[model samples]
Target: MNKPIYILGIESSCDDTAAAVIFNSKILSNVVASQKIHEEYGGVVPELASRAHQQNIVPVVASALKKACVSKEQLSAVAYTRGPGLMGALLVGSSFAKSLAMGLDLPLIEVNHMQAHILAHFIEDDSQTKPDFPFLALTISGGHTQIVKVTDYFNMEIIGQTIDDAVGEAFDKSAKILGFPYPGGPLIDKYAQLGNPNAFSFTKPKVGDLDFSFSGLKTAILYFVQNNTKTNPNFIKENIADICASIQFTIVDYLMDKLKNAVKETGIKEVAIGGGVSANSGIRKALKKAETDFGWKTHIPNFDYCTDNAAMIAIVGELKYKQNDFSDINVASKARMTF
Candidate 1:
């Protein structure tokens, strides 16, 4: 802990293969190799994702080290994502990290991908005030959705989660129905700017407290389009922008509603969000608006930090290293990890 702590972090949990170098909490280099193969299929295919990671990891890590102007011998520890992602993808990063750490005689830190997403807020801008203990976090991604309570650096409790489809999944599916290309959530946000959010009303699903159900909302959109298009064949084509806006509004409202309720129940003022959907413009706007409306402090990672990246992994690794928390080579990859 005396010398400047430098860590090498690897992240290949899903489609993106990433590596980063961090000196203490400051990120030196962050490199991500995104897979373009998934674009043809509308979503990630596990086998293909693994193959892509295999091809990307080594070069990604080398580039990160070069960019950071650091050599392998200077690293104090090696870190990699160990779970809550595609099993094959996780294995690629975990195995590589283990081998590198062993060869370098360095400690190994296994990080939870979701936990890294939350900690990403700390990496890019060290000036941002750190969230207080007992802060509430909302993590929304394509595969997962949950409300978490962070009691400490490594202690987290899941208090609310999706009973069915996640909010990001709903957004992508709705975009598909609208004939947008794969990874269409961002496109929806773009087109929505040209339309009115109140142009149409979509009913929010009635799910019990703390649990979210986006399946019903997806169904409603399907039926609404089916019935309306039957009477007016050009309905979707003519009102695409408005429909996108309306759908985006409903989804954002649902997320904010649950977050508000979580704050009310937990009685915690510090709030933050992480994961891919956290990059949505609507979500960012709503969170900032809520700060004034609800009189609560809010924290959000930058756009790059919000999505899958390795800077977050480096930050989490730095924390684990300080606590002497190390992972064994026998640690295995997991597809679904719980807090």
Candidate 2:
């Protein structure tokens, strides 16, 4: 058997300060310190989010190590999210990883936040099935909504992506219009279950066959609510469930339509979804139905992997570690990156 490799992963790409310890492709422990303060502002305040990461990074990492029953000495490399996130937040993780790797005299691996979401499936867990290579990965979250062609662990190409607001933003923004709080995407999903999906209709955007756009749908919802509430006054309260259901269905259907286009374009039957929004019950049900309805194989990660967490980063780190792909101490954090 090959010798075991331990990698320490840190993620502070947004409001969550997370750390994880991985043994090869399996995760030993994952710790995340979420910034609840952002909920008060109705959205993440980048400056505040970074400050919170600075405070949580140390303890979070310590907790992950303790939970894994592993020491810093056992770690073979330090992995951290390097880009395509809030610059200040990304720096907190990248800087700490660099310093720790330097002290331990270990390899430093910088991972892309988006790719981490897709690579998260490779983590050896009994509850989840890993996707095959050359599969289609639909990454949907607050920051991105993309369909990527994954040919290998490290080789991925974004075949389609949102031109404007991401799907998560569409959910959250729609929730806000309905008087839901920050991080309201789940709330929308919760209420969507009780109402009729076709209660209201919002026209899907006329984007390219593969690309996506949600801004128009968001505006349509806003106007619909405004027009209805003008006379009814209690329109939202009276039809909260139906409104949520309709919105959720619209978004989820739009996503499926795009996925269908991707599958057709690539001729790939295996599909996987990652990122925060994959936790949506509607999307999950849709993916499951597609297995039987469309004859496509589907993969969904556990709820932990769906959100912004360190396990994904650790998995990417492990993949890179095997290839001896190390980053320099002078590597800088980026606010935007592409596959």
Candidate 3:
């Protein structure tokens, strides 16, 4: 029992094939193989993504083990994302992790992809501060947008969630309308800093105070671009920065508003954010500003953990492993799962 617990984590929830090794609470190494093929199609193609995972997962896991200076035999268990993603993509990770665990006679842990994003904060790291219990977690990503109430390592409640398109989709779709390439969320964030946020305004959808809806916002943006370009063919080119800034501004503002409401309802002053969108510069700056303006504490994981990476899965695996939580040999992946 005194020996360190090592977990080999695998994540293939989407286009990224990730693997990581965690020693106790600290990450020893994390590696991700991103599928650039998705960029050509403007979004991930599930079949292609699964095939890429098949090709990349082995090398990625090997690299993680090598970098961590640990052999597969040293690992106490294998953890992998099991659901709420493309079925084919989820299968690649599940099948590999199951096989590895069985081969080693080790425990196999099934992790919720979304839950991993929230637990990522607990990964022992010098660069980040862990959130306290009962804090609010704003999870923003391409496929999900939810406010989770984390009361413990495993006890989490989704107090609020999107009714339609997730925040990341809103960002990417808006950027696409601007003629930006696939995975345009980051591009939107980059250009946002160069222009005024108020240069263009998009109305936030009228969803319930806790629930979010971004489909309408995407439609609004599409029309705005279409109408504008009719008058000036070079409209987007001339005002790309301002347009991006404005879209980013509205999305961040809407997210903040929901977080504020959650805090009010739960009386939880401590806030944490996770998921890919958490890396957006505007949201990070806004969280920093909230610490001063609202006297609230905030936590944001390091950039690497903010995205869909295996380190998060490893950390969650470590937590569940502590509780003796293990899945059976019959465990299967789910295309749609809930925390």
Q: Least accurate stretch of 10 residues (summed lDDT) in model 2?
A: 2-11
Q: Between which residue pairs do clashes occur in model 2?
A: none
- TM-scores for all predictions: 0.97, 0.99, 0.99
lDDT of 3 by residue, 114-152 (tens): 999999999999989999887999999999999999898
Residue 95, candidate 1: how far off, in angstroms? 1.0
lDDT of 2: 0.94
The candidate that achieves the highest lDDT relative to the unseen native structure? 2
For candidate 1, write residues 275-314 as lDDT tens digits: 9999898988999899999998898877778778899899
Note the residue pairs that clash in candidate 3: none
- Report how far off residue 7 is in candidate 3 (Å): 0.6
How does residue 217 of candidate 1 score in lDDT? 94
User: How much does candidate 1 score in TM-score?
Assistant: 0.97
TM-score of 3: 0.99
